[model samples]
Target: MFPADFAYVRARTLDEALDLLDEAHAADQEAKLIAGGQSLLPMMKLRLAAPQVLIDIADLPELRRGGWMSSVVGGSFGGSIGALSTYRQLGRDALLNGGVIRGRNENVAPHRAEGVPAITDVLTVLADPQVRARGTIGGAVAHGDPASDLPAVLLALNAVLTIASRKGRHPESHLGPYTPRRTRKEPLNIGKREIALDDFLQGIYTTDLADDEIITHIRISHQGGTASAYEKFPHPASHLPLAGVAVVLTYKGGRLTDSNGHVTDLADGSLASAAIAVTGISPRPYRARAAEALLKDAFPTQETLAAAAAQVTTESPGSANRVSLLGDQHASADYRAHLAEVLTRRALAKAIARGGRSL
Candidate 1:
């Protein structure tokens, strides 16, 4: 739509999109995928991200739909993601939809449930109503924009990304040797299958999107055995979190669960595992595993929680936006780190409480 002289081609379905791409550029790498146009258009307009050809994958119903997808940890498949789902759509699917922090209609309530706390509390700061209306979860994720909130959440959730091209498919019949436990919801996908989140995501704005290939879906899970939480420092003007953290824990206490299971007693299991994914402070979301190790086995208490909160950051933090609170505003990186630690402690305490505070 800008000064770029790129050709626009719309396909009615995902297969068609892939087929068209396959035909146009069998081995070429100049085609770009267009879904909601929220991420693509902006970059195009600014001339920061322009492609010679815009392949519209919006028409794919598979991308727009939902499906059941999950696999056993240390077993087989991981999860699947339907390509077309937008954040708005996934936000309303009833399964994933709940108390949104800042949704225009019904808010997705942030809750500490099953095993871990919810990040819906941070959603209110993602963006304005108008911007949200147009943004898709897929778009936000595919772009891998460091500043985006949902992207970091997905990372902490350990979300798996699905990609496909007219050229080839993934290990359809066999999941790789490594199968991480389901820490989030099972991904529902259309094209290829779910690859581990680490394997699925290549890098910042750079992925394994093959020639004429695009991401079809993403799947995440926080099944039983995992407790998690999210916290964010938002930008007042855009509601975007300058720093966000998503924590996922694998508790063997037989207490930690997800949106579907029940909480029991930690004494029932004897061991636990937990991890945190962080964003807004780095180029991409990162895990706060080192901080988590400090809380494991340590019975979650107010004091311990506070102590744990102090350890949220071991790495240097990025810059806060040029804004003020009352007169001059600046939530120093140290403050954000402290806040992240606090949220982590709260979420962990909640998890321990659900387990009867029994170490």
Candidate 2:
């Protein structure tokens, strides 16, 4: 099913895209932005997104141009990751995908781990090099597909998004934070306000986005010494994750203090901070806090799967176990959940292993 006829606009500058966004939003409130047209165009071809206008922004300087090529990290104890990184690129640099991958590959860059098993899985999930090459990090985040891998990766990595309008630029935000009770007001909602990393991105195929908002840039920090992982339950039909999970763990190491003047080999990296982000289970990427606490305490194990399953349900109380196949064959939502649980355990395990015996 081809898309209905629509006006097309090729934006050359940031201002042009912003102006087009305003016009489109005013006219129909559902116009789509095309970056690389990798994701959007196909959706258009299938009539999944029938925007009245297509504003191609892949050519825009802001989204197309990569910054200076320079390595930010280096040392004997802690090595450096080279520039222009990709999941495949990191593997070329000897980065581990998770030491254990639960699913197949999505060969584009989720860029979650410097090198981890989950990263390679995500690269493969995104499919052939041709599609991955044309895909833009900014487009995926803005598209905010719930089943999409990068949304989960960005949420876990605390990747910040920038939105530009006629009013200049403002921070992008998402919605979410599930609770124990169904009675409490859901805390995930974005508004005409400044959004921080922790509070953005609410649920699957959902966001705090407005009709006029256009995503401009993505901001992620290179510090934090985070040991990270990504996991996905990819569809047999599409190879896109039915559910995806990502994790970041920080640990500290130093000389031991005297306890009764005795020192022993409990010397390993002590988890300093930890964050778990899960996609596919909910409307948006959500922090798996309970699973995080368990992983933080015990690292990854078979038991960790139980803890994650518990917490993931907390975020997605309304998910259906049934499958709504788009074609002849596909995976059910329940199967996806099971897959997510598998990836969660592996990703957490991988990050912890990377933490190693730091102390």
Candidate 3:
């Protein structure tokens, strides 16, 4: 099947893309932005999305750059990836794939970010090589697919988004207007703000993106002593996760004696903070806060991990039998919940090992 007839317009600049979107909204015409066209094109061909106009921003230079910068004075390490950055670029980037440098300085202290392993793990099995080459991170995020691999990882990292638009150019965003997560220098000439990935994602195939706005970049940050990993059970054919889990553990000052009488250096060798997120088993990917609460500040023992993992089902925390799970031919809701539990345990173990210490 072919996508319905639509007018195609290539945008040479970020402002031009916004202007195109603003015009479409003013005329009450359906317009969609296309970057790599990896997700949208498939939906269009299936008649699930039929925009009357397609705005091409694939060639915009501002949205194609990907790099990271560290702030030692602030005691924070972070970076941003452009909206047009493809999965292939992200997977191959040294800095993104565990090359992150953290802590004060090399002479005084050095550390690795806890967030890199999850990014590397997801990118490795996200899809086939062709899709990784063409699928942009921004597009995958903006598409808001519940089965997406990256969103779960991003959610676990508490990622932030930088958006560009002129105020009042489009109707209010579904999740409301943008709110800055922190203070940052803006472009001045254009309206810009940052949003948390948690707030940015509203539902399946839905997001907080305004019709007249464009996602400029995705920002990620991590404290010095954190460890994170991602695990997924992919479908045999489509390669989408039957259930995917991402876990991030933040450790702080302490030492622990292992079963072998060897001392391990950690923040007490226990989890100071833990974030667990699950995808591909519900209407939306969500942080397993209830499960996280169970593991936070505790030793990641086999018994403790199993107990926390069991709390990762689609059932709402504090509610009995109130659950919503995705049921399809590939897997039933019960099966997905089981997979979520299994993956959570695996992700936790992998993250702990990556932290270079055992509980």
Candidate 4:
């Protein structure tokens, strides 16, 4: 199948892309932005989406910047990632891999909360080399595919997204006399709005992004004494996650000592916080808050972990009508829900073991 005939425009600058989008919206024309074209191209070829104009922003210098930057927000030091960064770049970057923990008190142990193993772990098995080479982090996220690995990982990290858009252009604007007033062509100083990653994903193939907006950057906090890991069960053919789980644990106090003077117990003061996010099971990826609450302030034993893992399916308690599972040709709802519990337990165990001592 071939897509409908469409006009193509390549944007040289970020502002130019914004202006093009604004014009398309004002004229009441369907326009889509293309970066990496990994997701959009397939949809277009299948005739699922046929836009009047395709605005290519792949060459925009602003979106192409990739590197770690020192970020301090609300007295917490962390890192910011440019949205246009490719998966390959993130996987190979030494800073993103396990490296020196920066912006922390010297007294803190380096192994506790080191680098972003959660991200690197996902990248290692995300897709094949070809896809990783061309796929951009921003594109995968903006597509809002429920099966994508990064969304769940980012949610577990409590990451924040910076969306870029201008105030004058509205997606609902039309070209008639009732058309909204257009502002003068000013320099492309995109107005940025920060949204939490969990809130950003509204549903399957849906997001909080306005039609005219684009994701500009992502920010993640790097708390000391935090350990995180990602695990997934991929579809045999596509390698997309059938069920994926990310776990982040923050530890406090000294190592735990058992009754016999052995230091293998994970007792009360061992874990400070726990964050778990799961994907590829329901209509959308979600944080297992109910399950998280069960694990908090408790000993991380096999029994306790099993109790919490069971809660992964009961996203909300006392709601008999809630449909927490999603069924498809690949797997039944019951099977996926079971997989979620199993994967969550495995991920939690690995994360706890990793967080027990420095990487």
Q: Over 4 Å off in model 3, which ranges? A: 71-76, 100-115, 168-189, 254-266, 314-323
Residue pair clashes in candidate 3: 252-267, 253-267, 254-268
Best by lDDT: 3
- How do the residues 164-221 of candidate 2 rate in per-residue lDDT, one tens digit apiece? 4554334332332211121132122211233443454654445655666666545444
Ranking of candidates on lDDT, top first:
3, 4, 1, 2
Q: Name the best candidate (by TM-score).
A: 3
Per-candidate TM vs. native?
A: 0.70, 0.69, 0.86, 0.83
Q: Candidate 2 versus the native: TM-score?
A: 0.69
Q: Over the stretch 20-80, how does candidate 4's per-residue lDDT look in tens digits? A: 9999999999999988888898889999889999999888776665445533331224666
lDDT of each: 0.57, 0.55, 0.82, 0.76
Residue-pair clashes, model 3: 3
State the lDDT of candidate 3 residue by residue for 1-359, as single tens digits. Answer: 99999999999987778889989999999999998898899899999999999999998777876566755443346788899999998876655575545445467465443337888999988888889989998998899898999999999988888788887222444335555432243344467667778888878899888787788889887666678899999998889888999998887565789899999766557778899989999888888877888887788888998988988873545645524788888999899999999999999989988889874
In candidate 4, stretches whose alpha carbon ends up further than 4 angstroms from where it belongs are 66-77, 99-113, 168-189, 254-269, 317-323, 357-359
User: If the candidates were sorted by their TM-score against the true structure, best first, what order would they fall in?
Assistant: 3, 4, 1, 2
lDDT of 4 at 226: 69
Q: Judging by lDDT, tell me the better candidate of 1 and 3.
A: 3
Please say which candidate is ahead in lDDT: 3 or 4: 3
- Of 1 and 4, the candidate ahead on lDDT is 4
